[model samples]
Target: MTLVPYQGDALAHTRTWTTLHDEELRRRAVKAAGEKDTATLVSLTLAYLTQKGGSGVLTSPRTVEAYALGTRQFVEYAAANAVNLLRPGRHDAQHYINHMLAAGRKPAGVQLKVAAASCLYRALRWAGATDVDPFRDASVPKDRTPGIVKRPPYSEDDLQDVLEKANTHEKFLLFLIAHAGLRISEALALTWDDLDEQGRRLHVRSGKGRKARVVAMSTSLARAARQYRQQYGPGGPHHLGGRRATPPEHVFRYGSTFTARYHLSKAFQAAGVTFRGFHPGRKYAGTRLIQQIKDFGRVAAHLGHESVDTTRKGYAQLAADDLKGDLAGW
Candidate 1:
């Protein structure tokens, strides 16, 4: 079997691959069969999935890219040791994990890399491109760091202080994440049209796994958004920072996630609060919602999670707080 070189560019490949069928995958397998090196074979598999949308196996571009990167790392490691990535066995998987540990990669980072490789193998298997999944039984290292300190949620006073310190742009971003329980990615992805003016709901189009959901906006959030629109002209594609944007851009355009984090940290420091991260705002929202509603399912839905268990795991510490209150009553 001779693997033909992928002839598609990034944009075309992304658009075309989402609609791939099984017959096309079989044909692709023939084209990929001639590749002698495991690197090429791994690359071919990723290209096919990237183009084919991984048939729900890969979920999103970010996920596919992560897996591709992980597979590349594995392939390079295997090549140095004269091993074939495509035909790797359990021992090869273990060796890769050991190598990552030896190279000082954090347990969580190595875990993600291993998961990425596992996902690639799973995708290939689903596409009928390969039968071997070396990472099937790989033992991912656990973080043994003592006394892992979880970030505490900002108190209401702390949150308000931070908000008061932030400029309009920063305030809006913080409010959306803190009040609405939006991930930074989701808040940034919002467009003007995603807001239902009359209905008072926010349409989150790019939740994890690219799931879309409509979350009812609080009266305060709705008022803030309206005020923001009036102050900043609403001609742009995005509701936030798209006015100066070329076209079809995100709302708040930081250069990168790190830049956003830096701005957020600055805001917290200005307010004289300890800066944990924007995620603590999410934790604050989760804890409040779970406490108020006492319904994990409702909290999960509000947070755009697929399962209540996810919501529970995130806000489990709140349960301890609840128990403390109960103990006081007793």
Candidate 2:
């Protein structure tokens, strides 16, 4: 709290106390809020949020993108409803949450948007854009779904069929995720130098959380890598639609992750497998490896997880029925 000269009378005797966060920085913030320049607000917020957060050298791009989209949506909503960006009405954030809920957004989706909006407002205050955070009190519905039911992993047969039907590019890409338990982002970031086919290991230089680790490759994954290299490495290419050899440095090249997903989906279609997205393949790897090894710590490390608990929370996709046989004669 600070004192400000009262704006009431021409002959006011004293100043009045105000609760504005930063009076000195409010000038530009007030101006931007008054002008409703949400684009500037969003761009600035994204830069602030994505810059080497936590223990990582860089924030995940997926996180950066989600925050960007969520922030943009909030600002756009504010602009549409004539809500002041800096000084949103006390209930405005809740109102936006209601709007999203009514629009069929999931609770998780709503939470992300609210978090992004709140982050942007805080950043605006830091950047001297605004001193008020309208989203501070806004809340979304809590999820009630059982944790075990979420993100079930794909079956081994499903992976086998996918690889059988996929072309060389798609085949090896799935091999990285399904066999090696690599995230799609990590798989897409792979280079030829990262693979040791004969040694049956893959060096994941850019694992999630910016943690680097070498994954033990399956014999199948190693064999597939060797074949992929021999077919597509510095030679006439028959796989990539005869479009010459893929770049020597890059492993899977389809322009972007989106393009990679498209081809992978096509391969799933050809194999008659359900396209439940890519992470399930990683889940499959974790579940299968844990069942085989019976050690959460080792499997979690192999999966590049920071902890066994993290592995259990996200990748423990096995049902009770699936685990029944393990204790049959114990």
Candidate 3:
């Protein structure tokens, strides 16, 4: 019943548990909980939740992994300090939050860690393992400092430089984010079948919140897709992949999301452009589309936002800048 190190991928652990039969999952949980050890108890409960679809418990793979890591942190903290995690009270939750803050963790990071601990307790309660929820009303500190300074969207000239210097695959990725306004995750999740050659559209099967939509592709992007397909052979379900003859299920096979970002950043560096991650491309696309259409609702729909308010809030700075000229004439 030794607690395993939590360094490996939590998603991999979740996926393994999810593929097991219910009885097997229960057997594994039982084996892990050979004793009444608190760490083992938390691990077994998480395993059970991962196997049972995590409904009200763990939501997505990212969330599952985040919670698992957070729980391990908490469990390690408890073991070190000789605190009883299984029956923790509100004070214990507050202490954990304060401890993370004292360790120089960012306020947002501390909040997420607290949230993960809260979710773990909720899952344990649902599994009938714990009766107390310490994080139910824990007073987590707010990030009162001025919000993070987001890097401004690339200027037209810088964007042009990026487009000119990008290689074939890199160019496609840039176009998807910059011109089409696809989020990095959405762009990476695209497949050859999502492309509509006749209609010149790209279908986003499942976007944020499991919503789906179709977005019109620029003529240049459509032409590039056709050329890319012809040159590399039609990719697998994912629109991008490794240089090998056979494509994988995902777009970038560079291990993880961070690796993909590193490659993109390298391309930007090579182009002599400031690299601010992919979101700036999306912001550039949104700003340009808003100026072109002059319709917030239309812009919202194009960006796959359920509400125009959301779109407006996200682009408030751009909106203000766009209105300056109109206000000057008035």
Candidate 4:
């Protein structure tokens, strides 16, 4: 029941719809979605959420994927119960949430799906698509996962243990987060060109929520990186041999991001340390730096964080006993 001839045109069932900003097209499509079956609107609305003009912020693909997964799950649930996916009321949303909880879904998983569904509705309502925002003001429960500290940061000894056990790719990756305070995604997106002056300086191009920054490398890291360059530098097997010959290839040139995280977990297992995720590695770098320098601003700058307060609150995991001497005069 498409209001437009989308079935015969290029915008039938693809992201090509994203490029067209015709208000009439949007109005017609959304109007039909409300009156008729919303079967195709699921993908259309999900794809629309990624548009900057639609969702405000051009959401990252990873985030968009999560949104799609949750939205589709909600659509499936609505279909099973004969609930309207496009026009669900607040009670319908609450019922779906309660159903998930009763079915033994974790609190965090429920929250994620709910959040995604909310985003979907938000996108539609923004464009006057449905005038139905069922998730708005919907009751969402707090995550009651049993853990005092969600993910505990690694200690210096813990990092050393993992470093010793890690393979070449894993070792370098661990250094990026544990020593240099880079996000795992940032490290995975690294290219040979990001290193400067023989790895004495590093250009972090994949910073989260901020522009790029250049960080200076320690003597030991620089030396190790230099050695890595000699081993896998230009013309090496992982260098520039693929279809993207013009662009610099990724430093950790794995086939896909699928196997990259597995390497880190394997190292953690061998080192007998719990895999607390890659964020703990950045936490290690921040906490260790804060301990040595005793300055939140310096540590924040080193970690590429925007604020000293963020560094102090989130990353600087200094024990009160260890900081007693440093704080005595202050």
Candidate 5:
């Protein structure tokens, strides 16, 4: 048998292709190409991402954490049913789906799991592993009953009160999320550099689905943001520089989602207001802004929506005279 040129250079190849440790390389290559062991693939994927973090597409710390968690859950599900992912058959995929449905997991929750599995399979393929991707043919129907319910918008008065009384970071965060309709993660990931004070714009490097967009800033919000910068941002000696919190430099780093949620809840309770979810504030902002601002396209663009139809869908009902004119006609 002819010897391969890199016969003893396996370690070098592994190091070249992946950032995995020496021990990890041995662990990953232990499984044969056609093997269908779910545990091994899941573990290998986790190890691969962990070892090659910042050097691959998996750059975000939160993304790494999320993948780690999602992989653990997938492993637990597979081990309980003795299904291997490396060679997942239709039966294995169906069983996992059934398990998730029976466990009363929300559709969104199951979708996250599906997404994690898909990502892992893609990574495995990229790593030159021979495994069939189960997610390619397995997708939940859109019309199927969702595990989560759509939340309603907040009343104008109640929403305004929440904005009025919210603390520094809370107020700006709420404003950015509500008026700008920003995702919670996007709102949290913002920084001083992302904000354009002179041009009155906020740059979202990567919003949902990794899409980048520049959203216009409201005059009121711009002024508030400037004040926030002067007081808490990376500036003079009072700013605390990088010594604040984990990634303390983030615009919304003053609190976590739980903390922000609690703050909003308390504000609601104090104002005798109730909301189905935090999203209502966003709805309220959009609806009210449309009524006050004639340029629907501008409003849509400022809110980072891809089209004006989406803006109209939520705000059309809040037409200027919808309430007063309808009542008078009655």
Candidate 6:
């Protein structure tokens, strides 16, 4: 596959690929490497990982994407300054750490930078470099400043106003996201067969990086899905006039009322919800579940979080009474 090219550079850089044989590109990568040693390695490593998957202990797609983006920015800086990346010592890595701090990237961003460099160091070792990995002993600073926090979920009454205003398709999308906790990609990629009416749940056949997960459906959401199916059922040239011409498994379909640039935006507009797209809605529902359901394990599983700790961190909101109880114990 042809990778998209990046603009405004001395080398006219493009994304890294599995077998990119563009002479000028490789020469630019090497030239940038020779000047800004750490930067070049960081860039090349992120590119390699993005193409063939990661090399470090963690294979999570989210982690890989973070490292790729962090390193890409660092390399752009190196290319502009003409620094050689291959010969950098720990001092070079430290310099980068300082630079990120000055740029207000904080610990999480620094962690990604370190991770990108660490991945590159491993690749270089495989390519016959004898130097030590600068990131081996490196760590994110304890005093690192925090980034912007995510917003809390909407309250029940507020959510009702939005839902009440939404049209049929809009309401269906919000129902799936808010009630079911589906990622946007998962909701968009859904097919009809994945839903089992009798079973009362939907299978997220594939998720980020193609991981599979099963999600339960609410009684209300299932009803909405049925209504939408009948309204936009298999018909004309849109599904294409033929025997196998079912409205391809994709759950969301374009509506004449509003060209939904994105499912959530259209839903928000239709529903008259004032806040951001469906994430806050999902957050709201998950938080409500925490208060309404006593079982922690069930809540975590239902939300598809890796652990209960994550569920608490993202969705739990402590009431004044609960906070006072802890203070009383103290």
Which candidate achieves the best TM-score against the true structure? 2
Please give the ranking of all candidate structures by TM-score, highest first, separated by commas: 2, 4, 3, 1, 6, 5
- The residue-by-residue lDDT of candidate 4 on 14-127, one tens digit each, is 344554566854675566444434445555555456453243344444665677678778767876787765667669988988999999887778989998777667666655
For model 3, the superposed segments whose C-alpha errors exceed 4 Å read 1-59, 102-107, 141-152, 235-259, 307-310, 319-321, 324-330
Best candidate (score: lDDT): 2
Give model 1's TM-score versus the native structure.
Answer: 0.72
Model 3, range 173-282, lDDT digits (tens) per residue? 77788877887767767766787756889998757666889998888778766765555434433344335332454344443456668767777888898888877777
Candidate 1 vs candidate 3: the lDDT winner is 1
**Once model 3 is optimally superposed onto the true structure by TM-score, how far is the C-alpha of residue 151 displaced, in angstroms?**
5.2
On a 0 to 100 scale, what is the lDDT of residue 144 in model 3? 55
TM-score of each: 0.72, 0.81, 0.73, 0.76, 0.66, 0.70
The parts of candidate 1 lying over 4 Å away from their true place are 1-11, 14-42, 51-58, 80-82, 101-108, 122-131, 141-158, 196-200, 235-259, 262-265, 272-277, 319-330
What is the Cα root-mean-square deviation between model 4 and the actual structure?
4.9
Checking candidate 5 for backbone clashes, the offending pairs are 36-87, 38-84, 38-85
Runs in model 2 deviating more than 4 A are 1-29, 50-57, 146-148, 235-247, 321-330
lDDT of 5 at 263: 61
Error of 6 at 168 (Å): 2.3
- Estimate, for each residue in 210-295, the C-alpha lDDT of model 2 and write its tens digit: 78999999998888898888876545364354342336477764436787789889999999999988889888888888777778
**Per-residue lDDT over 1-330 for candidate 6, one digit per residue giving the tens place of the 0 to 100 score:** 223433333122314422455554455555545555444555556455544453332344456456666666666665675534566555667777777888887666577777766666555544344355766666678642211134577678776777777666777777777888776656766787777656778898656545677888889888877776666545523343334322465555532212333644654566666656556766766776776665557777776667777666665554446556448867
Worst-scoring 10-residue span by lDDT in model 6: 5-14
Report the Cα RMSD per candidate: 5.3, 9.7, 5.4, 4.9, 7.5, 6.8
Better of 4 and 6 by lDDT: 4
Q: Candidates sorted by lDDT, descending order?
A: 2, 4, 1, 3, 5, 6
Supply the global lDDT for candidate 4: 0.69
Candidate 2 C-alpha error for residue 155, in Å? 2.6
